[model samples]
Target: MEKFTRLTSVAAPLAEADVDTDIIFPARFLLLLDKAGLGKHLFHERRHRRDGGMTDFVLNTPPFNEARILVADANFGSGSSREQAVWALADFGIRCVIAPSFGEIFFSNCFKNGVLPIVITGEAHANVMAAARTGQPFTVDLEAQTVLLPNGPALSFDIDPWRKRALLLGLDEIGGILADDAEDISAFEARHRVDNPWLFLDDGRMEQLLSQGDGK
Candidate 1:
């Protein structure tokens, strides 16, 4: 996961609401086991026609193709609990997604995968959508929690302190737990071993178990 301190690049505007996981990365693409190469498949159905010709979608057009930020309407990332949606967005070089609201599962998955899903309303959302339409670049500063508009004004947004820290350090859930409490984990393991000595095998027994292949 890459640290998301600040991102300044062209934003693509998708003013449609309820842009679900299927629309973002169709279910057929989920057969892919690895996160690599999903970018090309991002918004696959919308970007391609039945004959494999490209459609006039925003992402298929110029300038927006290289967009690093996405400004979308409310209820962005709405159906299904697919983490691949985040993977596809990240692979496509979109570091941040600004919307009026997001599906709860999608919102949580974004942080885990290094995508910043920002919730903004009123003036902030309007300004970002306007900037994106003009193909102007905007900046999202996670540390400062501000979205800098092209013209002048900066819009502030809120993020949970721990999630913000995790993004800055590029730590996933397990990585964060280990980094923050390695000592505590070690201590707990030590105590567990002492309290449940029968769980541990002697050298002779361990070797026997290994030789048998199946521990039982």
Candidate 2:
């Protein structure tokens, strides 16, 4: 996992509403197990022609091709839960996404994958989208919970404190658990081993037990 503290870069504007997971990663590519190299397939259909050539999609062009932020329309990332959608965005160097609303699962997945998904509505959303269209650098700071638009003042966004911490530390759920309870876990293991030494069998103890069982 990668930590997402702040991102200041040109944002690719995806004005389409309800851009679903299936469209982001595509069902056909679901068979791909590895998350690496998923950037090539992001928005596959939209970025490709019927003849398998490149289209003039925003991401296929200059500046946007190297975009690290995305400003999308309402209901972005809606549809079936496919974590690869977030993976694709992350693999493509998108560390932050701004939208009016997001799919419940997709929004959750973003935090797990080290991508900051920000929700802004009304004039703020419109302004961000407009700035993104101009291919100007937009800054998203997880620490401050703010999005610095190209022209206007930074707009505030809300996020769960826990999720914000996880992203800041580049921790997944299991990593978070380990980090939050490392001392407790170590102390518990020491106590458990003393209480149940049989459960802590080493190679020699296991071999001795096996030999005794065989003799019996």
Candidate 3:
């Protein structure tokens, strides 16, 4: 996972609410084994017509095509618990998603993949959406927990402290758990070795087994 600190980039606005995971990455691309190369498939169903021709979607346009921040309406990422949704966004170079609300599962997936899902409501949400429409650049400061608009006052947002720390340190859930309890893990391993000697292979025993195999 990459460390997410302060990101300043062009933001694309998708004002529709209830934008689901299927719309973001589609079900067809879900068969992919790896997260890489999914960027081109981001918003596939919406960005392309039935005939496979490109549509006039915001992401398919200039300026917005290079957007790294996405400003969306309420209930963003609402549908199935597909982790690929976050993978598609991250692969597309989108580091942050600003919405009034997000689906619980999708919201959690964002942090796991280094995508910052920000909940900004009321004036701040309106302001950021407005800025995105003009293709203006905005900044998201994970350290400060604020979204800096191009012309308006910075909007503050809240995130779990542990999630923030994990993003800052580029630690995924597994990485965070291991890192947080490294000493305990080491101590447990030491105790386990003493308690269950049969669980480990003794060097002398291994050498004896190898000698027996050679003799056979």
Clashes per candidate (backbone, < 3 Å)? 0, 0, 0
Best by TM-score: 2
lDDT of 1 by residue, 1-216 (tens): 799898999999999999998899899988997999899999998899999799999998889999989999999998999999999999998899999999999999999999999999987788789989999888899989999998968899999998999999999988888888999999999999999987887999878878889744
Q: Please give the ranking of all candidate structures by TM-score, highest first, separated by commas.
A: 2, 3, 1
| Residue-wise C-alpha lDDT for candidate 3, range 16-92, written one tens digit per residue | 99999999989888889799999989999789899979999999998999999999999999999999999999999
| Overall lDDT per candidate, in order of appearance | 0.92, 0.92, 0.93
lDDT (tens digit, per residue) of candidate 2 on 69-146: 888998999999999999999999988889999999999999889889999999989999899888878788889998
Error of 1 at 91 (Å): 1.3
lDDT of 2: 0.92
Query: What TM-score would candidate 3 get against the native?
Result: 0.94
Q: Once superposed on the true structure, which residue ranges of model 1 sit more than 4 Å away at CA?
A: 197-216
- Residue 138, candidate 3: alpha-carbon lDDT: 82
Q: What is the lDDT of residue 28 in candidate 1?
A: 91
Per-candidate TM-scores read 0.90, 0.95, 0.94
Q: Which ten residues in a row have the lowest lDDT in candidate 2?
A: 145-154
Q: Give the TM-score of candidate 2.
A: 0.95
